[model samples]
Target chain A: MNPVKVIINKELKVIFNSLLFYIAFTVFFCTTGFIYWLSQGNIFYTGQASLGYLFTVFNGVLFFLIPALTMKSISTEKRDGTFQLLFSKPIKTWQLLAGKFFAILIQVLLCLALTLPYYITIACLGHVDHAVGFCGYLGLIFTTGCYISIGIFVSSLTSNPLIAFFSTFAITIWFQFLFEMLSSWLGNTFIASVFMYLSVNDHFDTISRGIIDSKDIVYFISIISLFLALARYVICKSRI
Target chain B: MNVIVKDLTKIFDYQKAVDSLSFEAKKGEILGLLGPYGAGKSTTLKMLAGLLRPNQGSIHFDNYTYEKNESKIKKLIGYLPEKNPLYDAISVTDFLFYMAKLYDIPRYKVTSRVLDMISLCGLENEKHKLIKELSKGYRQRLGIAQALIHDPEVVLLDEPTTGLDPNQTFGIREIIKTLGQEKTVILGSHILSEIENTCDQVMIMSKGQIMAQGTTAELRQAPNSDFSLKIVIKGGEIPAIQEALNQLPQIKSLQLQHKQEFEVHCTPGQEIERAIFELCKDNDWYITEMTPVQMRLEDIFRKVTQKQ
Candidate 1:
């Protein structure tokens, strides 16, 4: 078997067995469910069967949820000295990171898959744009990949999971909101355009609106690759 | 597989944890790394395990160098790091299976391998229990089991018996001795006697440098090595006996433990025993007891490490 698959299997088994995963899943399910059905801008209030509002709420909730799920991925391994066990095996550092990245991504995907009933219910009530829903889910998946990579990167920077959690949350906040805010405040300057391009929310907004632009896809892929590369670099440098 | 390490060095912050250290171990040999705390034994073992990259060194297993064949070398090595770090949340069986899979054991073979380690490590009763619930001794055994789960040719163990009871230590030593019969094993410990009893070759290190390296008997026979004898005489007066023992050129010093018992220090490679027997025969002192005390590894360890 591939070592990455072994790591992924172990990681998933560990996560699923821990109480933390269930709590994160519950909080995600509840918060998104309440916002979609019972909150002020709920579907009942808007009288619209579209999942646009629910996708926006998911975008907001996942900002914190992804970090929660990924906080312990690498940092805990370093803290527990299990990195020695993994690194000493016939496994490359990238394989280790890739395994963890996909394990956590699988978790986020599982959580999202559980909410498919919301889509079905909305479709039953009124005519729903299947294309928009599919694109919105794709956007969330890309956003999840981007956030998970960032979380794993920050996780590699420290041996403390709390620090990994907060740093990831703090960094994603910048990409999700602060960069966009700063770009708007700069009034369309070249640096502002760079900031806009850097903002994860900008690309997510474009894709979630039922339009899959190559530029947006490229933005998410580059961000994911950049952070994964950075994470690999951090691990390599620190192991010495 | 024979393992060779050359000029291995690891610096943390600005301090050298392992200086330009080097050694070699052939198949069927157990090379013990003996040192006090902060003497870089663990650092050296970590480098050998390929978990830590050396600042200036190279390691090779048989014909494969780490620089060119890291994975190949890793597949042949089994390392038990200090403190026996394990995944506490998993069962003993799960942890071993996880390790087996990580080492790329065939799917059909992993279960049997895990079972073998569980039995070899004496962890059959605790196989279903989570590792967190295990005692320190069981944990150490589990650590060794995981290191050996893949049946690697080279085993590197860092302080494998650090916190075990006498019985547990004996069990671990038995396992190590069994491993040394067929594989190249490098064992690191600060405990001198453990190394003396278990290793084929001993390397005494201090401050990241090797102070002495040789077989146990070779180290014991080094120049300036001294032996002692405990003698008890029945007939001679204390002063006369002391004088007679002192007159022997081979006897260095004498201490009277009780009225009739005397402790005599003798220069190494001397006929002090025969000389004392002859002296007692001439003086009409009846010899009751005489026991030779061999030079201990502790003395050699202190002698070499304290010099620096």
Candidate 2:
């Protein structure tokens, strides 16, 4: 058996068994459902008849949701000595990091899969561009990969899951929102462009426009690899 | 597997946790590592198990050195770290099967192997229960089962019985003894009596260095300058036994202390226990008891470690 698959199976089993997953699943769908349908700023109330906010609003929910999902991925194992059990096995640090990253990514994908009905509902009511919605989902997944990597990296820094979650949140809030805002507010064009390029939201925005640019893809992949690499290094150093 | 660790050292926080420790373990031997808390017993085992990369030295299992060939070495060893760690959310059966998969056991063989481990560790009754619901003993059993699921040749158990009650420790100890009959087992603990009762060979470690390593009897006799033996013979043949003892070249001196009791002193570097019994067999004299008097393991360990 591949070590990554074995780990993913364990993570999925734990996630499915957890009541907290169900709670998060509920809160996520409820908030998204309310925002897109019943709320005053909703597409339904504004008669826009488009699910344009789906990616952006869901990304907002995921900003907090993913850190909670990934906080214990590495930290809890370290705290309870399960990492010792794992490190003793014939697996590398990269396998451990990849296994955990994809485990939380799959959970996020499952939650997104549940919201497919909303997409169907919106499609039935108005003229929706299928290509654009597809790109939005793709961008959402790419951005999630970046966030999961960040979460796992922070989780490896400490044994406390709360610290992992909060540090991840603190770091990602800048990537997810603050950097993009800072980029626009800055008067210097060079500094603004650097922040703009660095921000996850900006790259995600480019991809979310239904355009699959190679540069944007490279940006997300680079961010994911960088954080995952950092996480692997942290785990190796800490275990030694 | 015949295991050799040479100059195995690990430095943590600028202090050497395991300092140039070296030892050899023969195939199918149960070697107990006795040490105080933080004495590097676990660290040495971890280095052998490939959990920790040693700063200096090498661990060689037969022809394969650990640093040169890790995956091959890993397949030959199973390590259960100090605190027995397990996934509490998973059922016992699921966890074992998962471990079988992790060990890369063939898909068809996983069930039977897991069943064997479940029975071997006495976890059959709790096989369906979640690990979180288990008592401390059950958890420890599960930990051992995972360590053995793949049938590795070298099994490392660090403080396996640390927090268990006597009964729980007994169960794990029995399993370890059974494993020792066919596998090289390294049992690490700070408990003097635990090592004495369970291990065939013992290595006393302190301050990241090995103070001494030998069989219990050898270690007991190693430190004693005077070699003494107590013999009890039937038919009250005191003079005959004393004369027979006097004829042996290894016997430095012999005396009949009582009618049925005789004491023989052996020269240095002589193992007289086997020779005395052989002498009784040859003379047609029935020996009721032949005991080698020596220091206890506790005394030997304290004496060897504290001196350094």
Candidate 3:
């Protein structure tokens, strides 16, 4: 097997064996399930038989969940000195980062898959726009990928998991809301447009609305790649 | 493979950790790096293992250099760091299998290789145990097992037996000696006896520079060229024995050790033993005991390292 696959398998096994995985999985499922059904402005209140509200709520839930899942990816390895063990193999720095990236992505995807019951209920109630629903899931996957990449990059910067967690949360919060907020405050300027474009919320919004623009896809991919590249660079520089 | 390191240097925060160190180890040779703490032994081994990049100079394993063939070079090296970091949550078998896979060992052979390492490191009983539950000696054995699981041509071990008991240290040294028969093995430690027992070529390092380098016998012979002998005689007056020993030119210095025993420092390359036997025979003094005291590596290590 290749080094990336070996790393991913080890990572997944470790994640599954830990109590943290069960806790994160339970909390994410319960919170998203409760908000979609029992909370105010729930499906029954709108009575629209659409997943639009659920997707919006999911965006917020995932903003926090992704960071929690990815906070220990690289930081724990650094702190425990297992980075030496991994790098001693024939694996390149990017392959290691990519392995961790996909492993966390797989975990988040598993959590998202559990919400299929909500989708089933909505589809049973009335006609659902399948295109928007598909796009919404795609948008969630893209957004989760971007968040994990950013989290891994932050995790590489420090050996403390708490610091990795908080810094990732801080940075994702800026991308999720602060950028859009700043863009709105500085209305109609060139820098404002740049901030608007950088905001993850705007691109996710565009993709979830059933408008599969190349620009949105490019934006998400670029952010993921950029952060992963930065993570690789950080690991390489730290070794020296 | 022959491993050659030339003018290798590593600077940390403007302080040299390994200062232009150079050496070579041929295949089937064990090179021991002996140094005190902070003498850069670990740093040198790390650079050789490709865990750290050197600030200058180069390393070549056979025809391969790290610059153009880092992955290739890595594939040929098995390194156990000083701290021996491992995944505490994983079982020993799983960890070994994972390392085998990482090194791209053939899938069909990984199980057999893992089994080989488990038995070789004497970790048979602990193979199913979580690493966190094992004692430090077992953990160290597991560390070495993982490093050797891939069967790399070059093995770099940093203080492989730092905290083990005498038995465990002996086991590890035996394993190292076995590896030295077929691989280019570089063992780093500050323990003089361990190095003296296992290394074919010994390098004593101080302040990031090599203070002495040669075979154990050669190094032992280099400094303190004089050899000593302990002799015990009976049925002769102490003054007469002392006078007879003092008359011999080979006896440089003599100290009365006990009632009838004397410690004699002899000049090198002389027939001092025969001369003492002949003198005792002629004087009617029976030689009760005679034993030569060889110079030890410890004395040389102390003398060279403390020179700074």
Candidate 4:
């Protein structure tokens, strides 16, 4: 494998070797299953089942899980002094960030995969919109990518993993809830529309409702790329 | 593999870590950086490895400037930082392979090259173990193994034996001695004896500047006005012994401060001992031991830095 793939593999191995990834996976699965069961009422949603509920549930769950997964991306490297060793080599800064970012992607994917049993249950119970469910998953992935990128950027800012986790969790939660709180203050003005539109929760909610708007997809991709770029810049400057 | 550092300087807030420092290392030769703590040794090494940009100077590797050919320079160089930077959870084998991959070594070749490095550093049995579980000596070996995995042309080791036990120190010293046979090596340490034993040349750094740079023979030959001689005297009046030794013909000047001791300065290479022996024969002030105290590297470092 090339350096990027090699680094990705190394990081994946490290993530799997630790018990944190498993813990995050178990918690996400248990919570999503419980919520799905509760939302079913006594008959477990005999009507058409939509993926929107799953998206909402996972969004809340990722608010905690993403920070847990990405808190050590750069912080652990710095604390262990391994950052200097990596910098001394011939590889560029962007490759390392991409490698680590993809590693976090694999973990998020695994957590999503653990919900397979829930998907099977949904398919067995009643009619479901398979296309909308797939699109909803694509949207969840897009938003989670943005969250992990933001988390990685926050991780690069400090060597303390707890601080990285808290900062990332706080920023993600703030971005998700800021506009809702802003609307109450602005009294539903036109400016509140822009704030609400800019919020990640708003964009994710729009896409999870079986609507594939280009603008929502673009917003998620751009936010992820921007944070990943910032993370690259931060690590480069700090390494030098 | 030649390195030229010109007027390099780095200032941190109120202190200059490297202050107009300049030096050069020739191809296939070991250059020892000797200095006490806070003497800019680590800072200088960091700049050389391109991990830090100098504040006010240029570094050139061969004919290429450091900035213009950073990737090329990094490919040709291997650096072992003062603090051993190994991932605790990574096995020795995996770490070496990771570094080799970074250097663009072929996938099929990385394994054999890694094995060669492990063997060269005598880390064969511990190659499968996690780095954090290894003893300090073994961890140091792994550090060297990683640095040499790609077989870079220039290897810079900072305090490679700083915390190792005596046997470990000897092992590191031996590896360095062998590495010097094929690759140009630069090591930074405050231990003067290690430099004297392993390096072909020494550069003494102090307060962000190089005080002296030369081979041991060349440094010993630097002009000095005074030479020390430790002479043991047999039973005799201390005053008489000093008086007899002062009358030697080759002595330019003499001082009789102690009863049995006297400090004498003479022309370089002049033999004043014969005259002293002749003068002392009558009084039976036998000379027990005669040794010349020439200027050493430590003396030069202390004298130059103290003057600064």
Best candidate according to lDDT: 3
- Cα deviation of B68 in candidate 1 (Å)? 0.6
Ranking by DockQ: 1, 3, 4, 2
What lDDT score belongs to each candidate, Candidate 1 first? 0.91, 0.88, 0.92, 0.83
Cα lDDT of model 2 by residue, B1-308, tens digit:
89988888899989999999989888879999999998899988888877788999988899998657887877778888898988899999999988888788899999999999999999979999999999999998999999999999999999998888999988988999999999999999999988998899999999899989899988866745457788888753667777777889899888777778887777657778778778877888788887876767888888878876
Best by TM-score: 1
For B1-308, candidate 3 gives per-residue lDDT tens digits of 99999999999999999998999999999999999999999999989888899999999999999899999989899999899999998889989989999999999999999999999999999999989999989999999998999899999999999999999899999999999999999999999999999999999999999999999889868745568898999988999999999999889999999999999988777989999999988988898899987778998889899899
List DockQ for all candidates. Answer: 0.81, 0.53, 0.75, 0.67
Per-residue lDDT tens digits for candidate 2, residues A37-135, read 777888867786565687788888888899999899999998999988887777888988888999999999998998899899888989889998999
Backbone clash pairs for candidate 1 read none
Q: Each model's TM-score?
A: 0.96, 0.88, 0.93, 0.93
- lDDT by residue (B1-308, candidate 1, tens digit) is 99888888888999998888988999999999999999999889888888888889888888998788998889999999897889988889889999999899999999999999999999999999999999999999999999999999999999999989999999999999999999999999999879988999999999999999999899888877778889898786899888878788888888999988998988777888788888888989888899987678998999999998
lDDT order of candidates, best first?
3, 1, 2, 4
For TM-score, candidate 1 versus 4, the one ahead is: 1
lDDT of 4 by residue, A13-86 (tens): 66676786777788888887777777554235535465677677877887788999899999988888888788
Docking model 3 quality class: medium
Candidate 3 local Cα displacement, residue A110, angstroms: 0.4
Residue B123 error, candidate 4, Å: 1.2
Quality class of the docking in candidate 2, CAPRI style? medium
Please give the TM-score of chain B in predicted model 2.
0.79
Q: Which digits, one per residue and each the tens of the lDDT, describe model 1 over residues A66-127?
A: 88888888898889998988888899999999999999889989999978989899999999
Give the lowest summed-lDDT range of ten residues in model 4 chain B: B254-263
Model 1 interface DockQ = 0.81
- Interface RMSD for every prediction, one decimal? 0.9, 1.2, 0.8, 1.6
What number of backbone clashes does candidate 2 have, counting pairs of residues 3 or more apart or in separate chains? 0
